[model samples]
Target: MPFALYLLGLAVFAQGTSEFMLSGLGPEIAAEMGVSLAAAGALTSAFAVGMVVGAPLMAALSLRWSRRGALLGFLGVFLAVHVVGAVTGSFTVLLVSRAVGALANAGFLAVALATATGMVASDAKGRATSALLGGVTLACIVGVPAGAVIGQLWGWRAAFWAVALLSLPAFAGILHSVPKGAAGGPGVRGELAALRSGRLRLTLLWGALVNGATFCTFTYLAPLATEVAGLGTGGVPVVLALFGVGSFVGVAMGGRIADVRPVPLLVGGGVALCAGWVLFALAAGEPAVALVLVLVQGALSFGVGSTLISQALYAAPGAPALAGGFATAAFNVGAALGPWAGGVAIGAGLGFRSPPVVSAGLVAIALVTAGMGRRVWRERVGSVSTGAQDK
Candidate 1:
């Protein structure tokens, strides 16, 4: 990777750390704030809602500033929010701080994706995007585990302090590293035009379905490890670590596979994800099988990100900003829906493993959609070729 890309990755790492570290500290936060685990979990939901609202709002508003400036501004906002979160005494205040942090995060990620991809050659776009997103995957590997340890050793408040401290250097890195590119507002009309495209719609659908499925399984992963897999609280960290490792591997492989064959890679990811979910649902009663299935599911599902983003860019050729924003929105939409859906199943006495079962069903539907998209692409190409032959 280039020097600038490396710096951007660092920023991404910090952002990822701040965002995902919440999962590891959930129990500690609940206890510290004198709230229920479910209430603490709502912080995650609030973050997703902020992303859904902020991505486009920031993208559209940032048109006047250079991408570099936009990134820097967003990071500043992120830092402020984290600082507030760390210092606040009230649970409501903390919740608001996290929500604001999420809102800032939307712009940070959007600008990062747009900038990193722009730095590379056209053919390397997938790799570039993956490299940036890989930082997020890596957070699961490093930051989440580390945060959990911090919370266990020090306190949940200390974990937020750690996030804030870590973010400072990342903020500095962005100020020094990322370069400015494309400085014009893609007004509401331009953003709307990109959304109107059929390919973009398919991209959004693919993102939402795949991410929702993944989150449904992941949100209740701890419960599955405990209730179904017969693991103790001590085992939760280990299971999460294994899943993170799988996600890291998946992100790397997804980059390579997307470069080779974008659509086919997506199809393959969908297949693997469905298989993993099936395995999880059936074998969750066995500790060993559940552990293995979690890793596999993480690997397969998160790996599809490259294909989904690539499809969005291909579908909306000239408007990357809008595509970036919408793709992110789709991701958050899934993120918001997945946990709730899984929680409902769990409440209904289906057990924690039920999420994986339902997620698998959703992925199966996505597979059919992917096949339909492939057919449409082929027919369109054939018609154009036939028309040209007549000419």
Candidate 2:
């Protein structure tokens, strides 16, 4: 609702665009570089691995700087990396660019999320977080299409050039929107303590599993659609776009629901997510059903975005930045693992349908984990409340 929110959202849009652009450009890069598709796909995976490595590293480094400076610095790095990607003809050079870009991009998002949480009221945190992540949802729908077209029309190199150009706007937006003195205080010790706590550990584990299920299915959807669902090349992007639309809608609803009952919403969403995957496995055999199920799965999978974020923040109120960073890192770890595992399943002659079923099973695990997590968190909160009332 605030103007700062819009600028932050734009920054996220740019980041999301840059993060996902590789997926669309993978085949082009593979063909251009005379590498196999598997190797080209590794370009995308490299980014996720970078995120896992970069999130904590940059979060630690950023303790010395203001949030504004940290955000700006990362964006600058992101811009430069894209430029490098554009100019590099060597596959190794492109890999370096992607890795650097991924690292900077992860830090940028971690800081942006920490900044966003501080900008809003305690009650509006979930909604604010949702609005921020909604940019990513939009990017998946719009930015991917734009990147695909650019890669198709000019060159994949040109697509990277376009992303590089966006860093200028992202820098300008962050400088303009984020207040000069709005930086949060450092809490490296507190964050470490929180991470060591059982509650936080459980939450992260649940988040990782849930994320793995969702991303695994999504990462391979394009190939799966073509090989298993019998969808044509033209239809794959449409399905991906439809999935993005579902994500946008889910995040909006998740934001509102989280404000009322964050824990329950998370648990319910996990259940729905698992159900969506099951539906996907069954529906993949039917073109119409597959389309509908993909959209449903998208919404169900992403519906808990704000809730999961809010849960992590609440779990570690003393270390919001670290919590945010940890959540981001855990998510990417899932993203990395999901596709790799799905690829293995496909390579094993299980067929494309096997991955979605496997993903559903993972979601089912997350559902059970969410239930236990909610119970534990609720009991702890209740105990604290009782102690306060007695005192």
Candidate 3:
């Protein structure tokens, strides 16, 4: 991988810290802003909504712009918003800043994905994608916990300030490393036309379903660890860290082979994920078992999820810029829906373990979708071959 890809990953780490750190600071934010806890939590929802909307919108808007220029512009916006969020007195201002920051984050991620793959060999796209995504796993492991600690020690505002400061190096690196005038795609019209491909559509659906399954359980893991597994509050972070470790390993290992053996890896990982979730739900009362399952589940979730994302990019060859945006939108759709489904289950008296069960069902559906995607891929390839023969 190019050093530039590592810089992109570093940028993602800074953005991802802002994205996930809010989870730990919700209560502090609520107290400081004189709002309900739910309202503070809504900040996260606002970010998710922004990401879902911004990915495609920003990608299209910047499709013809210099890649380096777009990346620097987004990072500048992200840094400015965090500063605004840190200084804002009104809760409304903070909330709006978070959403705007997410718009920039989403745009950066989309462009970074296209940029990372472009820097690598065609056969190594999966590895390039994983290299970029590794920053997210690292943020989950190091950045979020560090941000939480910073918030707990100083104040929530300090955490926001930290995110702003952390992004400075990334902005500098991108400006230095990324080539000037490297526009993303052929054009907006060409990208839009590529969206009509059946393979691309199914792959995007696969990405959504796989991610929905992962987050449905992951979003509620803390409660499940404490209530069902009999762990104390102190143990919750341990479980989360363990999951992050497993995810890092998964991405590192799976990236090596995902491009070469996408079908087997996808099918195998999905099946394992479904079974792992089912087992997790059944063994929720065992503290030791729950801990181990969390790690395994994280590995399976990210391994398959990353592969699906890489496949989406491969599926949309004609839409280099839009492909990353579509993949971003797909994953965020699941990120939003998965937690909602989990919340609905718990709200309806299904209990903490229900989320894992729900995840299993989601994975099963993903498996079926993967099968349909395989057929579509085959048909598309066959038709192209037939057209060539006729010519």
Winner by TM-score: 3
**lDDT scores for all predictions?**
0.77, 0.77, 0.87
Error of model 1, residue 370, in angstroms: 2.0
List where candidate 1 sits over 4 angstroms from the true fold. 26-39, 180-188, 375-391
Candidate with better lDDT, 1 vs 3: 3
- TM-score of every model? 0.90, 0.91, 0.96
- Candidate 3 is scored at a TM of 0.96
Return the clash pairs for model 3, or none: none
**Which residue window of length 10 is worst by lDDT in model 3?**
382-391
Per-residue error (Å), model 2, residue 116: 0.2
Residue ranges of candidate 2 with Cα displaced over 4 Å: 31-39, 194-196, 379-391
RMSD of each: 3.9, 3.2, 3.1
Clashing pairs in 2: none
Candidate 3 lDDT score at position 356: 92
Candidate 1 TM-score, C-alpha based: 0.90
Better structure of 1 and 2 per TM-score? 2
Ranking by lDDT: 3, 2, 1
